[model samples]
Target: MHRVAVLLLAPVVGFDATIAPTLFGTAAGGDGEPLYEVTTCAVEPGPVASTNGFAIVPTAGPEALDTADTVVIPGTRYPPARTGRGVEDAVAAAFARIRPGARVVSICTGAFVLAAVGRLDGRTVTTHWKYADTLRELYPAVRVDENVLFVDDGDVLTSAGLAAGIDLCLHIIRCDHGVQVATAVARHCVVPPWREGGQAQFIDRQVPAGDHAATAATRAWALAHLTEELTVHTLAEHAHMSLRTFNRRFRAETGEAPGSWIRQRRIDRARELLESRDIPVDEVARLSGLGTGGNLRHHLRRGMGMSPSSYRKVYQGA
Candidate 1:
C-alpha cells in the first residue's frame, strides 16, 4: 500500500485536513484491500487545534513523513506559513523528513506552507480565490492561478479552498489507480467522481432567472448525447437562443467556450471508454464522437501526452 502522511499545522482548516484521508482511505482494490495507508501527523504530536472550533489529537509526529510516498499539508493558520515569513523550525524539519521524490501536496492555504519552504517557487499553484492576491504578493516567485480548482505540477500539487480539496484528492486517486477505482471511491463518499483540474473555481455568478433562460438543461442534454456531433450552433438552437447569446451565457456559466466545453466532454467520454471498455481505438472514437481514431489520438496526445493504447495499458494493466 502507498503510504500517505498528512502533516497538520494548527490551526488547520478542519474540512481541508480530512479530504485526503477520507478519499484515499476509502479507496480499495478489487480484493477489498485498502490501497493506501494514511497517517495523520504533526510537528509535535498531540492535540492540534483547528479553525473549525475543534481540536484533533494525532498519533504520530514528523517521523511519519520519513517513509511516506506522499506528504500532504492541509490548510494551516501558522503565522510563518500564512505570512510567508518562513516555515517554523519544526515545520521545516518535518518537511525535510519527507522522502526524496515523494509527491508533495497542499490543500487550500496549505500552499502557503509549501511556498514558505520554497517548494512552490517558479511553480504554478493555487489557493482560495480570496487569498490569490495575497499569495502572489507574498511570493512572487510562485505563479498563483486562483481561477482553477487545482494545479498539478508533476511532483507538487496544490488545490484551491475547502471543497476543491476533495476534487484534488479524487484526481490523485484517479491518477494513481484508475477511473473505476476513483469513481467507486467517489460513489462511496457521495461526491462527483471527477472535475477537470483546469475547470474554473466556483466564484459568485449571477444566475439566470429560471429554467427557460438557463444553459444547464442544454449542457445536460449535450452530456447525454456525447456520441453525436455537438456544435455550438446546435446547442444554441436547442437552448432557443441566438449563437452569440448562447455563447455569452455559456461562457458566463461554465468559464469555458461552448466549443471548448464540448470537445473536453467528448475527450472525457473517450477516456472513460478507453479505461472501461475493450474496444478498438476507432470504435472508441466513433462512440465518443471524436470522429476517427486519428482524431482521438490527436486529442489524447495533445491533452494528456499519451496515446489511447498507452492510456489503456496503464489503467487496465493489459
Candidate 2:
C-alpha cells in the first residue's frame, strides 16, 4: 500500500485538505484491501486553524513527511495575506523532510507553497482562476496557466481550485492503478470518473434563450460515431446549423473547440481499449479512430506522456 502524508499549512482551506485522504483512502484493490494509508501532519504537532471556524489537531509532525511516498498540500489563506512572503521557515523545513523522488501535489492556492520551495520553477502549473495573475506576477519563473482544470508536471502536480483537487486525485489514481479502480472510487464518492485536465474553467456563458438550437444531440451522435471520420462540417450538418454557428455553440457549451473535443473523445476511447483489451496497437488505433498506430503513438504521447505499451503495462498490473 502507498503511504500518503497530508501536510497541513495553517489556515488551510478545509475542503482542499479533506479531498486527498477521502479519495485516495477510499480506493481499494481486487481483494477489497485499502490501496493507501493516509496520515495527517503539521509543521509542529498542535491544533491548526482552518479558513473556516473549525480547527484540527494533527497527530504527527514534519517528520511524518520523511516516510511518505506522496505528499499533498492543500490550499491555505497564508499567501494572499502576505504578498511576497513565501513559505514560513518552519514550513520550509517540513517540506524538506520529503524524500527525493516522492510525488508532490498541491491543491488550489497551495501552489504558493510549492512555488516558494522552488519545486514549480520553470514548470507549468495552475491555481484557482481568480489567483492566476497574482501567481504569475509573484513567481515570474513559474509558468502559470489559468484556464485548465489542473496541470500535471510528472512528479509534481498542481490543481486549480477546491473541486478540481478531486479531479486531480482521481487522475492520479487512474495513472497509478487503472480505470476500473479509479471508476469504482469515483462511483463510491459520487463524482465523474474523468474530466480532461485541459478543459476550461467555467467562464460567463451566453446561452441562447428558449427554443434555441442546442448541440447536445450532435455531441451524443459524435460520441457514438467516434470510429467514423468526424469533421466540423459533418457535425454542423447533423446539428442543422452552418459550420460557423456549430463551432461557436460547441465552444460555448463544452468549453473546447469541436476539433479539440473530438480529439479528447478519441483519446478517451483509446485509453479504455488500452486498459480493458488485449489487442495489437494498430487495431486499437483503428478502433479509436486515430487512423494508424503511428498517429495513436503521437497523440497518446502528446496527451498522456506515455506510449500505448507503457500505459497498457501499468494498467494491466505488469
Candidate 3:
C-alpha cells in the first residue's frame, strides 16, 4: 500500500485537511484491500487548531514524514507561511524529513507552506483564487495560476480552495491506480469522477437567466453524442441560438469555447474507452468521435504523452 502523510499546521483549513484522508482512505483494490495507508501527523502530536473553530488531534508526530511516499500540506493560517516571512524552525525540520523524490501536494493556501519552504520556487502552482494575488506578491518566483482548479506539476501539485482539493486527490488516485478505481472512489464520495485540472476555478460571473437561455442542455446533449461531429454551429442550432450568441453563452457558463470544449470531451471519451474496452484503436477513435486510428494516436500522444496502446498497458495492465 502507498503511504500518505498529511501534515497539519496550526489553524489548518478544516475542509481541506479532510479531503486526502477521506478520498484516499476510500480507495480499495479488487479484494477490498485499502490501497493507501493515510496518517495525519503534526509538528507536535496533540490538538491542532483549525480555522473552523475546532481542533484535530493527530496521532503521530513529525517522524511520520520520514516514511511517507507522499506528503500533503493542507491549507494553513500559520503566520510565517501566510506572511512570507519564513517557515517555523520546527516546520522547516518537519519538511526536511520528507523523503527525496516523494510527491508533495498542497491544498488551497497550503501552497503558501510549500512556497515558504522554497519547494514551489520556479514551479507553476495555484491556490484559492481569492488569494492568488497575495501569493504572487509574497512569492514572486512561484508561478501562480489562479484560473485553473489545480496545477499538477508532476512531483508537486496544488489546488484551489475547498472542493477543488477533492479533484486533485481523485486525479492522484487515477494516476496511481486507474480511472476505474478513481471513478469508484468518487462514486463512494458522491462527487464527480473527473474534472480536468485545467477546468476553471469558480469565479464570480453573471449567470444567464432561465433554463431557456443557458447552454447546459446542449452541452449535455453533446456529451451523450460525442461520436457525432459536434461543431460550434451545430451546437448553436441545437441550443436555439445564433452562432454568436451560443459562443458567448457557452464560454460564459463553461469557461471554455465551444470548439475547445467539444474536443476535450471527445478526448476524454477516447480515454475512457481506452481504459474500459477491448476495442481496436480505430474503433475507439470512431466511438469517441475522433474518426481514425491516426487521429486518436495523435491526440493521445499530444495530450497524455502516450500512445493509445501504451495508455492501455499502463492503466488496464493489458
Candidate 4:
C-alpha cells in the first residue's frame, strides 16, 4: 500500500487537507483491494485548529512524514502565522526525511510552504490565481503560473484554490497507477473523470461549474485535425469568419493568436513523444509537424527551457 501523509498546519483550511483521504481512500489496487494508506499529521502533536469553526486531532506529528510514500501540504486559512518561521523549519525538516523518489504535493496556498523550502525552485507551478503574484514576489526562484488548475512538475505537484484540490488528487491517482484507476476514483466522487486541457486551455473559454472551458465548435473542430497541416486560413474557414474578424474573436476568447494556440498544442504533443517513446527525433518532429528536429529543438527550448534529452531525463526520473 502507498502510505500518504498529509501535513496539516494550524489554522488549516480544513477542506483542503481532507481532500487527500477523501480521494486517495477511493483508490483500489490490482485485484480490487485497497491501494493507499493515508494519515493526517499536524505540525505539532496535539489538536490543530482549522479555519473552519471546528478543529481536528491529528494522530501524528511532522516526524510521521519520514516514512511517507507521498507527503502533501494542504492550504491553511492563514498561511503566514501558521506556516511562517518555526513552522517552516519543521516542514522543511520533515521534507528532508522523505525517501528519495517519494512524491510531494501542495494544495492552494500550501504551495508557499513547498516553495519556501526550495522544492519548487526552477519549476513551473500554480496556486490560487489570486495568490500567484504574491508567490512570485516572495519566491523569485519559482515560476508561478496564474492559469492552470494544477501543475505536475514530476514528483512535486501543486494545485489551485479550494475545490481544485479534488482535481489534483485525481491527477495523483492517475500518475501513480493509470488512467483506469483514476477514472474509477473520479466516478466514485461523481466528478468529471478527465479534464481536457491545461490552464491556458481554459483562459478564453467560459468554463461551467467545475469545468475549464466552453470552447465553441470552432475549437472542437480544430482538435480533430491538430497533426495535419492547419493554418489561420483553415481555422477562419471553419469559424466562417473573415481573417481579421476571426482573429479578433479568437483572441478575445482564448487570449492568444490562432497560430500560437496551435503551436502550443503541437509542442505539448511533441513533449509527449519525447517522454513516452524511444522514437528518433525525426519521427517526433514529423509527428508534431514541426518539419525538422532543429525547429522542434528551438521551440522546445523556447517553451520549456530544456532540451528533449534533459526533459526526458528529469520527467522519466519519477
- Residue-level lDDT of model 3, residues 251-309, one tens digit each, is 77777889888888888788878888899999999999999999999998998899999
| Per-residue accuracy of model 1 over 4-37 as CA lDDT, tens digit each | 9999999999998899889999998877889999
TM-score order of candidates, best first? 3, 1, 2, 4
Judging by lDDT, tell me the better candidate of 2 and 4: 2
List ranges where model 3 is wrong by over 4 Å: none
Cα error, residue 12 of model 3, in Å, equals: 0.5
RMSD of each: 1.7, 2.6, 1.6, 6.4
All candidates in order of lDDT, best leading: 3, 1, 2, 4
Higher-TM-score candidate of 2 and 3: 3
Candidate 2 achieves a global lDDT of 0.87
- Most accurate candidate by lDDT: 3
> Each model's C-alpha lDDT?
0.89, 0.87, 0.91, 0.76
* Candidate scoring better on lDDT of 1 and 4: 1
Which regions of candidate 4 are displaced past 4 Å? 77-88, 200-318
Residue 13 in candidate 4, Cα distance off native in Å: 1.2
**RMSD (CA, angstroms), candidate 2:** 2.6
Q: Candidate 2 at residue 84, lDDT?
A: 54
What TM-score, to 2 decimals, does candidate 4 have?
Answer: 0.65
Q: How many steric overlaps are in each model, in order?
A: 0, 0, 0, 1
